[model samples]
Target: MLALAAFFSGAALRICDGLLPRLAADFGITAGTAGQVVLTFAIAYGVSQLVFGPLGDRYGKALVVCCALFGCAGAALACAFAGGFDMLLRLRVLWGIAAGGVIPLAIAWIGDAVPYEERQATLARLLLGTLSGMSAGQLGGGLFADSPLGWRGAFGALCAGYVVIAVMLLARLRSMPSAPPAQGGRLAFFPQLAAVAAIPWARLVVGAALLEGVFLIGALAFLPSYLHQRFGIPLSAAGALVALYAVGGLLYAMAAKPIVRRLGERRMVLHGGWIVGAGFAAWAVAPAAWWAGPIALVVGFGTYMFHNTLQTHATQMAPAMRGSGMALFAFCLFLGQAIGVWMAGASFDRFGALPLLLLPAVALPLTGWGFSAALRRRAGAAAA
Candidate 1:
């Protein structure tokens, strides 16, 4: 039920990605400016996680998550009826803030319920729900928009899903675990925050996850329009192609444990980074429409492979403070996403889509290499 709630919350935001061009056309805006609609959501999403993380730690995961869902549902309904681009943007920001708690809280809930050695596979399954929900959102939103009901109808459908999930969550709230209060009152929050900050490995994990968010959200948000403009594909067709990105993520989730075991986290992350970089470059330079599909698959697979490992690593990093650590990690990850969307929007506004692709291709690999190096240094210090 928790995972399902989280999935719906995430899917609601992703559905917006597919509707951007249509929404822009409706409101008399450019694709770049429409992209800002996504940026507003990303900014709110990232910033809200910081507060929600601590709130979850202090109050309880289920309660916080349920409330977030209700808020997200209300915000989605507002977005459905929004009169202008600004109104929709404002609603999206509110929706982002409300939905932000779902992911971290879900993960923390898993941590409370599951054991460490078994967590990798469980986390992968949870991520599968997340990735699949994203794909479904894009595909479903595209189809709904193409129907007589239009984009608003599509959003209204997602809003309905949110309400159903929230009701289910509220029913389950009594069975959920709550973190114990700290000795230092309000000051206890500082220690968990400080603990995550002080750990080099934790920092590396968060950094890699942030880069993953940059490539994942930024690419997904912009790619549909890019394909539409470049290949003259209809929105539905473009969204279907975008769904291939999640197919890649599904493949990674299926294969992550063995890959992580064989190659280790550092090597896998570095390799995944290179693969993602290659995928982005392919998308940027592809000479034909047929090529874009495979490139997206590669990029999606690599992005999730790296992200899954980072998330698993984060869960293990500070087990005693899992909620706090995970929250901090999620904070950085979403902050990167917010920045990615903002930058991608600006890049699209200025230089057009072609240039926007280059940023992730270069940034992802460099960040991956940096993370790998940091891990190696930590291993050496441990040996000493």
Candidate 2:
């Protein structure tokens, strides 16, 4: 049930990626300008992480998640009714702020509930909800936009899903027995966040998360647009094709246990990085639109293979302050995402998508190897 609820927020986050072309056309703006919608939402999402994390830690992660789900439903509904680009953008920011609370906190909630050795497998299973949402968001956004109901229908459906999930989650929250307080109640917000930052391992995890957002997610936001322009494909086709990325993610989720058992976290990240980098590099040079489908699959697979490891580490970063720890992790992530998308937008405007995709191809493997090395060093220090 929690997984089902998390799906809506995940969908809301990526839905706009596939809709950018249609939005640009509707608003009579350039593609780069339309991309600002993504930027604004991500910025708000990043900023709101501070509020939700602390609130979750103080009040209870489940309660906070339930409330945020309600807020996301409202914001998404408002987005459906927005009369102008400015109104839509504002609503999207609200939606980002609301939707931002769901996933990381849920992970924190899981961290609180599950033991560390088992947590990665549990998280991988939970990602089914998230990865499914990613696919639905991209495919559904494009399909709805081109359909008679148009882009508004896509958000309307999302709003309805949010409401349903919010109700279900709320009921569960109310029914479940309350958890004991952490830190004798919540510490003051800034101090809590500062303490999280002061931990070296926490710093490494969060830093890697931030760069992951910048290098990988930032580049992904432009895939549909790139397809539309480069190969003259329709937005819906491109969007549906990009949905293949989720196939890769789902595969990882299913295979996670064996992969982890065989490769260990460090090698999983290192190898996943090379795979993702190869996928993106291939994407940069793909001769036809059809090729992106399979390439996106590989990209998706490699992404989770790498990212899920980071997520697992984050869960254990500050066990006592799990919510705040996870929130800081997400804060760095979406903050990096906001900045990355902005920079990538400028790059897209200047150099086009080739460079945008190509650069990540080289950087992601390095990112993976670096994070792996850090993990090994941290492990060695602890053993010593």
Candidate 3:
């Protein structure tokens, strides 16, 4: 049920990816300008995490999540009925702020309840919701935006999903036991945020996650646009094809246990990085839009291969302040994503998408190698 709410929120975040071209045409802007919607949302989401994380810790994680989900419902509805591009952007920023709290806090809640040894697999299961949302957002925006329903219809549907999830979550919360708020002075939140930031291991994890968001998500935001221009494909077709990325993610969720058993964390990061790099490089050269689908699949698979590992580590980084810890983790990741998208949009405006895609192709592998090397150093130091 909680995962359902997350699915809607996640969908809302990514839906703009498919709608960018439509938005541009409707508002008489370039595709690059339409991309600002994504950039704005990511920035709002990232900045709001700082507030939501501590609030979740101080109030209750579940309670805060429910409230945020309700906020998302309202914000998404506002987006559906927005009067202009500026109105749409404003609503999306609010939607981003509302949706920001759902996933990280849910992870923190799981961290509070689950044992360390079993947490990775549990996180993988939860990722099913996120991955599914990604698919729905991408595909739904593509499929419905061109139908009689139109782009506004895509958002209206998302609003309905958020409302349903909010109801279920509210009912569940009413039946469950609640924890007392974490006791603190008026200034308590900043200290918890500071404490998590102080840990060397947490810093590394957050940094790596940020890079992941920057390189992977930043490049991906423009893929549908890239396809439409390069192949003259319609927005719906382009988006549906790109939605294959989530198919790859679902594959990872399904096989996470065996993959982890066979590969280990370091190898998972190393191999996953190489695989994603290869996939994007293929995307750069693919002769047809159809080829991009398979490439997106491989990229998605490799993404979770690396990111899920970071997620597991984040949950344990500051157990005493898990909400703040994970929230900081999310803040860095989305902030990186926001910056990445902004830079990529500018690059798309200037040089086109090929160079942008190819850059990440090289960066992801090196990032994996860096993480592996860091892990080895951490292990050696602990042994010493």
lDDT of each: 0.79, 0.88, 0.88
Candidate 2 clashing pairs, residues 3+ apart or interchain: none
Q: Which digits, one per residue and each the tens of the lDDT, describe model 3 over residues 25-50? A: 88999988999999999999998999
- For model 1, the local distance difference test gives 0.79
1-384 per-residue lDDT for model 2 (tens digits): 778976887788789887888888889988888888899999999889988888888888889888899999999899999999999989989999998789998899889888898999999988989999999998887787678777788889999999998888877876654345565444487788889999988999999999999999888899888988899998899999999999899999999999999999999999989999999899889999999999999889999999999999999988888888999999999988887788788888889998889889898999999988987987899899
- Tell me the number of clashing residue pairs for each predicted model: 0, 0, 0
Using lDDT as the measure, name the better of candidate 1 and candidate 2: 2
Error of 3 at 215 (Å): 0.9
> Candidate 3: which pairs clash?
none
Q: All candidates' TM-scores?
A: 0.93, 0.97, 0.97
Tens-digit lDDT string for candidate 1 (140-243): 76676567776789778878988998998798788766667334456677777787779878877887778777765776688887888889888887788887
Model 2: how far residue 60 lies from native, Å: 0.7
lDDT of candidate 2 vs native?
0.88
